[model samples]
Target: MENLFFNHGKDKLLWETEDKILLAISGGVDSMVLLRLMEKLALKETIFLVVAHVNHKLRQESDEEEAYLRAYCKRKGIPFYSIQWQQATSFGMEEAARNFRYNFFQEVMEQTACNKLMTAHHGDDQAETLIMKLARGGSLNSHIGIQVRQPFSNGELIRPLLQFSKEDIRKWAAEQSLVFFEDQTNEDTHVQRNRIRKWVVPELKKENARLLAHAQQFSQQLEWAEALISEQMEKEFQTHVKKQAESWQIEGDWLMALPENQQYFFLSYFFKKSLSELQVGAKEEQLLQLLRLLKKEKAQWQVAFSNEWFFKKSYQQFSLEKNKQVTDEHHVLHYDEGVYLNDREWIGILKNVELDKVPAELEQIGWSTFRQDFPKDLAKEFFLRRRRDGERLHLTKNLTKKVSRYFIDNKVMNAKRATAWVLTDSKNNIYGLLPFTLSYLSIMEETDKIHYVLLYKYRE
Candidate 1:
């Protein structure tokens, strides 16, 4: 037990003498054994021990279990917390109960000023979780099993007993003569976890005598693999992605250029960063489809997620944001040979052009003609920025329309409209092209007139 504690609980130890711990006890054998071990080690003298139990009130014995835990804590001279789940929900009963239980545990942790919340998830539980997640079809992240330490909101959740198997816990409890409650609901085969615990695990253990040990080892290896992948993914993200106040973006071509595994890994990482959880079931498959579609160059595209998150691809940039009213954010850039906009993503290129000597290939290269007699003065006042409301472009002298109306008329998506660019003179006139309108400032007629043509390209 000491070896397992030192090996698995090193990160959970806040301090030598003043650490406060909140134990989530269910009056079950595993938690009872954990309590006995802590008592034997005299941890209560060095650190404050608080036991918390949540009664779902689903079973008739739940109240009795809570009472038993309370009595035990009182005898040990430790604080005990109990909360009842009085609300009713129709679906996902187990998930709802687990969420409520952890929430109440977190509340107790906060109220008592505890640094860590401990659980009794042992090796069997870890194996069962991995199997369930695999059956539910999750990525490698789901295969990581139960984490020994994970960030819970602001504090940490530590499960030190995960290194020990269920048999080990039971033996410890028996040696200490510990009394624990048995929830009869655990025997109901209708529950998937109970079915797995009663039938699947026992059969597997018969085949491999040390199945629990193998499962624990596999879980640790998966966790290490996840850590390594995350480290590499962070490096890639730092090199190619940028997080803004209202949105997150990645350079399209750079992201697409990576290997397929890295692409999936980074996209999964981004999804978690944005939504705080992995997209599961059919939604995860849809997200993968969206990621594939984003690799292509589409004029206007958008994908919506279940949690009010939106994905948009415009030109050569991919962006993700929460569903909210997005206001225009303006960024200014001067005209030069190559000027970057929006954190060096979109680039503006300027070159001297003579109307007579303009190459026909220039049109093929996406160069928009910006003919002006005072080319140098226009260049000095030229700046590229995001579109604003009430802005209009002169499509022709007689054809003028608001930019917002233009988007509406052309079926431009709201996601694309947020980051679309508009070129204007110092007076804020619209010289729109492409995502912006196709109208030029003016036509070129004079052969001797010196002009400057500007075009935009996404930097890879």
Candidate 2:
């Protein structure tokens, strides 16, 4: 009994001594047990108990569930909150309901002056999720199971009831003679989770007789394993995430050399922990594919997870960053030998005219020393910057046409062509334009050369 409560009741420590709790009650067995436990434990405390419910309007019985939950909370002297969403006649009911629920939880927490929110996720729920992931082929993150004290990247959201098993909760509810409304939709097999709950666990249990216990213990062990790995990786990750003048980059060579499993673990971990502030999870196939292919020297791969949310692999570097929106900014640069722009992370060089003097010797050199090759005869240099105002450039060497017209002459995307910057002469005429257009022919020339160097920028 001591182990049961200590193991299961450990989550209560997260609650503030004098703070309020905004519990998400579904009027189901799981939430009912949780509510009753809170009532029994916090009955004498000076904490406020607020009930937050999402009326998804999924079934005819949902209204009754809501009413019952309201009445139960009222009887216990706890505050109650309920919200109803009129969903459209579309699919993805679970996802829509989840969205509604989470948004409503945020609203209720804000309105009630509570920052802590608790859910009714138990060990059985965790086990079911693991088995489902296994059936579909588990990845490195699938084994994370339910988070005992989950938080958003900014430490805003949290889950507390993840350590206890549903059986333990059910037994506790029985001991207290607690009653909660039954959700008829839970019995409907239309949902994948329901099917797993009805058939998968029972069948597995019948085969092993102790499979449930094993799974629970195994999941705890996996949590421990994940903790040890994460602790070690954090030390290494601190050294690897470096910053540059313009962007962030993690090394491909060092990242590729890690052990296979650790490679998968750290890749996903590093991206979620260090890169985009959005949530990330690994599909085993996708993780394996990236590890196998990210080694190619110059090959590129790109995928858009969502609008403006994209990841790309180019020139042996994996770039996870926002999409660049081009702008119409006028720029000028004087004819110069060598120039540097912190934003472009490049050193620009132009030497005296020599048709056969290609810039081969500048390849794969350090940023500090690359500009030493600049010829002193044409030493005049000027700096360039990005802007979004009206700007124009010449299309040809004759300086007779605007850069926009040149892009139009070549049928380039107007949105993309608008962002072209140019180098100018001392008299404010176009000498050459920076590369943004597809057919701009901006490659480094033998006598006229420019080098873009990727420095160890900070990780996103």
Candidate 3:
């Protein structure tokens, strides 16, 4: 066992004498056995080792376990770092604890200048993970289970014990006379992993003695398949997808042109590569519904992707974007006092402006800039506000058009329509739609007097 472990470290991990490794120790049997093996390797190869422990403060023995590990590390003359998870969560405690654990491990790695983070995920854990993922249903990526090694933070996360099962670790620990804590929570079947570990895995192992090895082999095979599929998907993505700031845009026709299966694969690949932080799930139903919506006859449609994001189909263009949560803007305008319409837009009223000799800045204010003349008798105090529902604009002396209808006629995107401002009076009389159209009442003719000029400025 020792020879196999040493060879695995030197060959598979490619560990050198100068390489500093941060070990995530939980005081459990699996991690304790890992620490013992790493210590043996350090003695033989002179490799640097740092011990990091996270005290979840969930179990009653957590404090004791942390103190025991700290003392053990000190006795071995090894650097020890530990953190306590002070924030208690009511639900999803297991996942929350796992996140806190790895986060502390990363901080320790950074502080100690370690280039590798090691965890003790064994073959049994891998089998359980695969079973849980398969039963729960997810994309092929999820079924790949815990990886033996992957990039984490500034370095790599390595699970050297993945090739060994739990029984093997326990047996080796016994032979070495190592003292390790047994987490009682592992016996509680209330947790899905614990439940599967107690009943489902053992039954499967009975049918096939090499269940652990087979599970690991399946994971490696799936990883290879995913790589091949991803290579092709990336090429297709570059050809069909357009990235705009934080959002992603794709041609609807291009997506619908692909085979139905490829469409699902492409969408899955796009979400995983581009918007991974959003944690969008690859549910078959959700993807099928999106595909159906794309095939509909409607020119434009939108559906919520998540609470903070949405998928929009505008004409022939499909996009995934963050929901723009804009508060209704209503600012009272004063002469020469500029008010911000949005983050980059500024609007103000200028008095006594010559129509022929507009300010140089106003002259260069792009096409979205509104510089219309309004009769001084229009209102005593004019304000700028976002377009309200059921509002109408005076297009002619006897013609009126719904504000929503005007936006549709002009083909303005839903996002743009939300930010469009309306120039109005205290009595809610619409003066004009800034940067788009002027109300017939606000338009100045050669016969009508122009006293106030509404100036709009947009900063790039």
The Cα error of candidate 2 at residue 335, in Å, is 7.9
Clash pairs, candidate 3, are none
Worst 10 residues of 1 by lDDT: 368-377
Q: Candidate 3: which stretches are off by over 4 Å?
A: 55-71, 83-90, 227-247, 272-285, 306-308, 322-460
Worst 10 residues of 2 by lDDT: 451-460
391-453 per-residue lDDT for model 1 (tens digits) = 777777788888888887776666656657776667876655434444445444465354555
Number of the top-ranking candidate, with TM-score as the measure: 3
lDDT of 3 by residue, 1-460 (tens): 7788888777885477778999999999899999999998888886899999988888999999999999999999989999999987989988888888887888888888999988999999999999999998877776888887888988899989888999999999999999999899889899999999999999999999999999999998988888888999999999998887668888878887887789878988887776677686446667778878766788788877678778888777788988887787588875545566555687767665444343455445352565666566566677888888899999899999999999889877777788777888888989878668788878766765547677776642
What's model 2's overall lDDT? 0.60
| Residue 264, model 2: Cα distance from true site in angstroms | 3.1
Cα-based TM-score, every candidate: 0.68, 0.63, 0.73
Q: How close is candidate 3 to the true structure, as a TM-score?
A: 0.73
- Please, what is the whole-model Cα lDDT of each candidate in the order they appear? 0.71, 0.60, 0.83
Between candidates 1 and 3, the one scoring higher on TM-score is: 3
RMSD of each: 9.8, 10.5, 5.3
